[model samples]
Target: MAEELLFTVDGPKAVPARRISLAEAGLLERQHLQQWVIDHPELIGNGVKIVTFEFDRWVSGAGSAAADRLDVLGIDRTGRLVVVELKRDRAPDTVTMQAINYAAMVRRFSLDTLADVHAAYLGGSTTADEALARLMEWAEGVSDETLSPPRIVLMASDFGPTVTNTALFLYEAGIDIRLLRYQLYETAAGEKMLSVAQLLPVPDAEEFMVRPRSSSATQAASRKSGERRAAAAQRLIAHELIPDGTSLTVTMPNLVGQDRDAIRAWLDAEPDRARVRWYNDLTAPVEWEHDGQRYRLIGLIRTIIESATGKPPQAQIWPTAWYCIDDGRTLNQIADPLP
Candidate 1:
């Protein structure tokens, strides 16, 4: 149990510490606790940033037993799927086994499936493809193929001896499982407070226990892969193919007099052209073929502006007119700018 200290000044004299009982505030209901975590997912655990929360997700077992509904499902920053199960009071003896089953069920979820979960949690405001792109952008050095297995987390007001011992045994046996205790407190003024603590693996023993699992060989291989990807990205930037703030001048002619319909038709007929829609609208970004390679209008504009001014363009909206010199013919083209 977690305790709090109360101090009162006694007319310029100091007073001894008065310990307050957090349970005096009364325990919160299970549903209410689940809602609190959904509202502030940061409270789920330390070192975890929740992507999205799925409430009461049903899971099926192999036997004839009924399906189990999970309290919350989330993905961490590194793309590892997280299964969070909450118990309002003391955790039962079989909570660890239950969590293990849940983890097993979700272990084989692909990146696309996880993205779909997030998108559905967000009420279809974004697609799974877009969510995947955003997740990749946020978690550097981690790819869809390299994500770790699903992690299981069990939260409750208190953990029983049987559950705690089982959690420790599973964790030592190489399972990514954690036990968290949520203690509620109330102040003298009728305010509620919460404290969360991670009780498994013991904080002091983490280095000795967790460090040996990430072997030196695996670390070296990961480092080499990252270096190789970085080199490739740098090469692309130098060639002005990737828009990563590198500047290069492209002296193409303006497409002021070119027929818009003709240009669109020509682009449509090109076999190498790839259709890319940044948004759902008629306005399309300029995409064209140059030197047997395809380039977007926004990339060209960014390259030109960055090269000329030594600074990235401030406006995120696409520029009105741009030039691209291809095969010694100055082609004037107009397409929707980036937003």
Candidate 2:
């Protein structure tokens, strides 16, 4: 059972201390708890950010029909997807199976598709691509290819032995899942306190039970790639190329006949800048354009050398830098870190 806090009155003062719950407090309706967690995801656990709520996945076939919906979907800093299932009162015996099914469905989601779901959940405040970029940054460039399996989280006011045993069996069999129990308490002044606890695998058993699989060579390669991407993102942030809230338009002049050393020197002098890509005549840029304003630099040469010479741009002279930024949408979506 989760622990609760109790207050004692001492002459003109009240002191609070920890106290284990002897009996279950009044239950919070599932919808209320869902909304609360949606508003405050940290209540679910540390480093968790709710990506979308009430996600619906249609599962219909020619002869069979079923509607599949997830209560909440989240992702951690390492890009591991979290599938959260919530129950208000007692958790049913089949809850573990239900969460497993949801995890199976969610594990196949690509980065772009996850971003689309998040954008829709945000009511179209930002484009899917931009949201995805931010998520990647938060995930420290943990690439989709290297993302771990989806983690199943079962949250309920209470769990029966059957559900606990089932969860334990799955965990022992190498499924990444956890159970969190929520308990609510009321104070003399009618103030409410909520306590959450991780029940399955307990704290001490986590190290042995949740270690990553043995794929040393593959993991090393993936880590190297992730590090490179993370470094690039950090450089972009440091150089202010990717401003936090405002959109930017970066223009680079064509370096056809320009002095390579001088251009390199100029680029080096710029603070917080990193080389993102080198574009040649054959290299096609994304066709989409920024919506509001168009900024153009005067005397800028626009010829693609590859086009003129019928050859690719020389690696030494390629001159295009790419940076990403949000598009006017507010992202107060994640929980603030615990103090």
How well does each candidate superpose onto the true structure, as a TM-score?
0.53, 0.57
List per-prediction Cα lDDT, in the order shown: 0.52, 0.56
Per-residue CA lDDT of model 2 for 76-182, tens digit only, reads 75567889999876799899989998887787787777878877877756777546645654554345553447878999878877787677656655676788887
The numbered model that scores best in TM-score is 2
Structure candidate 2, residue pairs in collision: 239-272
Model 1 C-alpha lDDT per residue in residues 225-337, reported as the tens digit of each score: 43322211222223434233222223323432223344345345543332221221112223433333234444544444444445444332122233332333212221211
lDDT for residue 98 in candidate 1, whole number 0-100: 85
Task: List ranges where model 2 is wrong by over 4 Å.
Answer: 1-5, 8-30, 60-65, 203-272, 275-339
